[model samples]
Target: MLIGEVARRSGVSARMLRHYDSLGLVRPTGRTEAGYREYSREDIRRIFHIESLRSLGLSLREVGQALDNPEFAPSELVDDLVERTRERIAGETELLARLRRIGAVGPADWEDVLRIVALLQALGSESVGQRQRAALSSVEDVPVPVEALVEAALNETDPNVAGALRWALARTGDGGLALLAEGLGSPAAEVRKRAVESIARIPNGAATALLQESLTDPDVPVRRSAALALGARGVADAVPTLVEMVVEGTNDVDAADALTVLARDSALAEQIATRLVACLADGTMESSARRRLTQALAEIPGNTASHALADLSHDDDRAVALTATYIAKLRNAQ
Candidate 1:
């Protein structure tokens, strides 16, 4: 076959075939009387082989080495190609996400698009200050897409930046809740915790309902954060986890405070006091746990808490006794 016929059959352009010949990648096996390049069957097969390697993302130089070098091992090269392809895919995926976010915002013009892009860049910046600033201003300045805020919020490690992201997401209303809810199921413990924390900051019925469901999350931190948020919202469902946190001494003070908030209801106050009293009565509880429980009960008003405190005032644990006795007197004095 001549060059044109070879190009037509192999789908390799004539210019490319000539370039390959110049690089000695695939030389013509013969020449006609007019001295035009002519390809033998084997030469056409080599052209097909080069095209096959190129499909696998091989550079021309790599393709030449692969076709010519008998000792060239393809294992390392193939692995490298796989890695490069993965990186390219990841980059393209992120670009698609960025574009989706920008389009979701419905930018009015190039200026609006630029502003959103800047905000996103800042949110993902290497500097903690830049990320923190971006999160803080994203909602107020340019109306960043809530999805971007949720994504940044879930992956943020810096406490201040994460807090700012949560604040921004919360102010964005319940828009980010669905995305944050997905984060609650993330395998990363930190992501789940961040998701809960961000949800906790959104003071709305939808956020409250989500927190209620998260109270049973498999992650302990997730459950605790959900419980704390629910407790603040006066949700009685968090009582069990709040009591557990008190016993475990994990954010026990905040847990106790949350329980106090939930106990403001007259009917719920007695029920809470009863639960705490029951926890104190458990034989398996340590003295420290009993002390924390006693302290928690002291904040609950009414006869149930008073009676429980009076009973605890004489407990065997000296610290529990002192704490309960001191609070009981304060209650009497009031």
Candidate 2:
């Protein structure tokens, strides 16, 4: 097998494979005539074993020892590995228990619960305990446990835990969306902003309806959150709101972004693109809107993208001319 193939099959990167080779763990048996590394069947077999051991959480040194001593007993290493595994499990179990105590799995609870569980597991209780005490020792700050992070996330009140939950959400993969949904009804605007940011982190399924609601929000932060979440989700529903926001608003980066996302459609992306192109092409828009107009047009697809730029090919605006040129180049490349 080729080195790339070996790396793919083993689920190890080429760089890591080379590192393992330097450590004498697994190496190519020979080189091709052109000096490409070649692997024998035996080398492939060893790689598979090494990968398995690594997945089992064995250290590289331990894996090397096991590889060198074919008769080495994994049983001897089982106890330490088991303890490490238990510590991991304990974090997940603790988080799950906390979630069960949360506001009873509301509209925002999705598969991301697993991510929060894993984050708690990865952060471990002991480190958090130390941090909590240190936080308390320095000032009169009430000691907030990690459980409070979830509790605050579940409640629309308690901005402290809500803020901390934002940090927690940042640590986890994309689980913060659920928390964002949970906070949509929060009485506080700051909470709403952080909630929007959390929702922005994942940008899919859960944020859609809420974002639709946010487009009509009384609060600017909430409205911005709605736009950002809609754009991040890349949903067609955001197109109208984005278009309106793009033409009417100032410093509405999130709104413009949402519109641009819609315009990039191969199939459904066109739902957003055509609206933007129409607005710019007819001169219904002012020069102030030209920058965002060009941006949205550029994100659009081939013949459609070219046609959008063609409207501005003879523009009196220098920025519009430059941006249109960029769009023409991109369309030709495609």
Candidate 3:
């Protein structure tokens, strides 16, 4: 076949075929009387081979090597191609995400788009100061999208930067709560903890509702964080988890303090006292856990708490009895 026929049939353009010939990648096997280049069957087959290799991301030189070198192993080259393809895909995905985030900002013009992009880049900056500054300024001037704020907050490792991000997110209102809620379901324990932590800072009913749902999270830390936040909000739903925290000795002091806050209501005081008394009476509770529970009961002001403390004062464990005696005396003194 002549060059044009070969180009038409193989889908390789004539210019590219000439370039391949110049590079000695695929030379014509013969020539006609007019001295035009003619491709034999083997030459056409080589052209197709070059195109096939190029399709797999091979450079022209690499394609030539692959077609001509008898010792050229494809395994390493194929693996390298796979890695390159993966990297390209990852880069494209990141670009798409950045574009989506810029679009989400609802930029009014090119300047607005650039500003949002700059703010986002700063949020992801390696410098802690830059990240914190971006987070603080996100709610001012041009507002950073809540999605960006939430992403920063969930992945932020520095305490100050994370706090700034959370503050920004809270100011953004419940708009970021949906994304943060998805973070709550992340398989990663750290991500779930971050999600709940960010949610806890959001003082909206929606955030509180999500926290209430997170009370049953499989991760104990997430459950504790959610319980603490809910307890501060005066939600009685956190009562049981608070009681468990007291028994487990995990943040038991803070848990006890939260319970004290919840106990301000007369009805809730009685309910809180009742749960503490029940935990105290459970046989499975070790002596140390019982002691923490006794100390926790000291904060609850009600007949239920006082009576439970009085009963525990005569318990089998001397340490428990002494702690209970001290608490009961304090209650009596009050």
Tens-place lDDT digits, model 1, residues 14-122: 9999999999999999999999999999999899899999999999999999999999999999999999999999999999999999999999899999999999999
lDDT of 3 by residue, 1-334 (tens): 8999999999999999999999999899999999999999999988888888999999999998898899999999999999999999999998898899888878889999888889989998999999999999945687688878888888889999988888888888788889999998889878888899899888888999999999999988988999999999999999999999999999999999999999999899999999898888899889999999999999899999999988999999999999999999988997
How far residue 166's Cα lies from its native spot in candidate 2, in Å, is 1.8
Clashes of each: 0, 1, 0
**Which clashing pairs does model 1 show?**
none
Candidate 2: the clashing residue pairs are: 265-269
Mind sharing the TM-score for model 3?
A: 0.89
Give per-residue CA lDDT, model 2, range 1-334, as digits (tens): 8889988877879998889889999879999999988989999898888889888999999999887888888788888799999999998996667666333333145444543444434333345443333222311122223344433444434344344555554444454465566666778776666666555554355556666777776786567656666766776665666676667665456676666566566776565666777777666667778667777666666566577687677788888888888778877787
Output the number of the TM-score-best candidate: 1
The list of candidate 1 runs beyond 4 A from truth reads 138-140
**C-alpha TM-scores of all predictions:** 0.95, 0.46, 0.89
Least accurate stretch of 10 residues (summed lDDT) in model 1?
135-144
Query: Model 1, residue 29: what's the lDDT?
Result: 91
